[model samples]
Target: MTTILVTGGTGTLGRHVVERLRQDGGNEVRVLSRSSRPYAVDLRKGGAELDAAVAGVDTIVHCASSPGGGDEQAARNLVAAARRAGVRHLVYISIVGVDRVPLGYYQAKLAVERQIEESGLGWTVLRATQFHDLLVRLFQAMAKLPVMLVPAGVSDQPVDASEVAARLAELALAAPAGRVEDLGGPEVRPLDDLARSYLRATARRRPLIRVPLAGKAYRGFRSGGHLAPEHRVGKGTFDDDLAARFS
Candidate 1:
């Protein structure tokens, strides 16, 4: 049986990945996290805990990340530990448009991708679009204001986190395929439309204001730099997700 370690196993995407891996059977799965849950190991600190997690693991699905900050250091530490343990494969989960988008978080993800590439270990990097639940949460936060401000000309192909997790599990079991095809949602929808849908689903009425943003990040999104139209591999749509959650 192949031994696999999954960092951020408690997270949204990581949780799904772990669930799928366990369902597949015939594999020993370990979860790396700060909590004292079963098979949990702290990966932020590259000491004995990290080493113990990496040691004897045939493959590592690296889903642990801090998009706001500290992602690069976390990846670096993990890569170092993997190398020390002589890991056979290291799979990393990254966001779509990390290279094209000008956001600081995207920049951090891109930096980690580069670190993994340079690590000289067998690796695969899968770049997926924003999760449907994340977009819902974004709209929920925006709904707090009297007037919901939506970024004009911005579009997203929000994929299901569970679908991404299944794909990651498939890649982890297979041989390392460096930088595979990008994974995207079933449809590309405007952010404003998504917000309107959310408001309608929740039966909340609010004045929607479309504000044209002026920044490199906004321009990138407006220009469809974050979209992968040809890679619409996901079967779930935002509307379907909303209907399941709210209907």
Candidate 2:
């Protein structure tokens, strides 16, 4: 049986990946998280526990990440341990436009991608557009105000988290293919429109306004650098997720 370890296995995307692998059967799927027992290890400060977790593992699906900070250090720690354990395959899930987007989190993700490529292990990196769940949380926070403000001219192609997890599981079971095609939702919609949809879904009325921001990052967003229009492989849309969530 192929021994696969999923880092951040209890998280949003990681949990689904773990479930899909288990449902497929025949593979020994292990979870490595700070909270998961028997293998609770923090990649940021990896030590004996992390080494133990990577030991004898054939493939590792790295899904652990922190948007606030410290992702680069975590990637470094994981790479070192994986190399020592002689891991054969390393699969990573990243956001679209990590290279073009100037956001700090995007930069950190790009750094992690480089770390994996140079680690001498068989590796695959898949970049996907923003998840619908992320958008929901963002809108939920923004909707607290009397007027919802969004970045002007910024659009997002939000894909379902489950779909992304499905793709990750498929890749983990196969040989390393290097960087694959980008994945995105069926349609690219503006943030204002999506916020309006969220309001409608929640049955709440709020005034929505688009505020133009200044920054290369905001400009990149306006120019659609974070979008993958040609690779619209995702079927579920933001509205689809909102309906399922609110209904």
Candidate 3:
């Protein structure tokens, strides 16, 4: 059993990956958590603490993200830490169109990828589609009002997080495959339809109103529309994701 280190094992996707590694496959997995007895160390501090924990690990599943922390600093620290430990493979979970789209979260992921590539280490960056829960959460926040206001004229193919995590684990097991194909939902649907579906699922009687936004992020989403409608290899659909919203 190859021993691997998974950052952010306590997070939504990180926890799933850890379970899959232990349950689905016969692999030794260690999570870099902040808690005692389990968490090896913190990567935010250049991974000195994690170095001892990951001394002999074969791979590093870098799921630990700086959601509120700036991406540039976090990515630099992680890459440096991995290099210091001589980790063989680094599997990073990122969103689709991160390079093309100029968003805070996506840009952070892009910076992380660049750091990994520049580190001269084995790496595989899996860019996933938007999680179905994200849209659900968005509607949850917006559906309260009589009008479910959403950005208009945008196409999205939200993929299941489980599928993405499975793929990330598989990629972690394999050799480095730089910049893999974009993973997305089976069908592409408008954002408004997705919002409506969420409302119906939750038995909410809210009408959706499309609102146009003027900005770089909106322009990027409208022009290319961070969607993988052309070559989709995902299995879950919008309804399927809605069925298994959260566990």
Best by TM-score: 2
Order the numbered candidates by lDDT, best leading: 2, 1, 3
RMSD of each: 1.2, 0.7, 2.0
Clash-forming residue pairs, model 3 = none
Backbone clash total, candidate 1: 0
| TM-score for predicted model 2 compared with the true structure | 0.99
Error of 1 at 132 (Å): 0.6
For 1-247, candidate 3 gives per-residue lDDT tens digits of 7888888888778888888888756788988866634565656665557667677788988888766765577567767777777888988888878888887877778878888877888988888888776777777889778888989888788877788888888898889998888788787888888887787677779777899999888988987658878757788888777766632
Could you tell which candidate, 1 or 3, scores higher by TM-score?
Answer: 1
The runs of at least 3 residues in candidate 1 whose Cα sits more than 4 Å from the true structure, single-residue gaps closed, are: 36-42
How does model 3 score by TM-score? 0.92
TM-score of each: 0.97, 0.99, 0.92
Candidate number that wins on TM-score, 1 or 2: 2
**Which of candidates 2 and 3 is the stronger one according to TM-score?**
2
Q: Best by lDDT, which number?
A: 2
Q: What C-alpha lDDT do the candidate models reach, one value each?
A: 0.91, 0.94, 0.80
RMSD of candidate 1 to the truth, in angstroms, is: 1.2
lDDT of 1 by residue, 94-186 (tens): 988998989999999999999999999999999999999899999999999989999988898999999999999999999999999999999
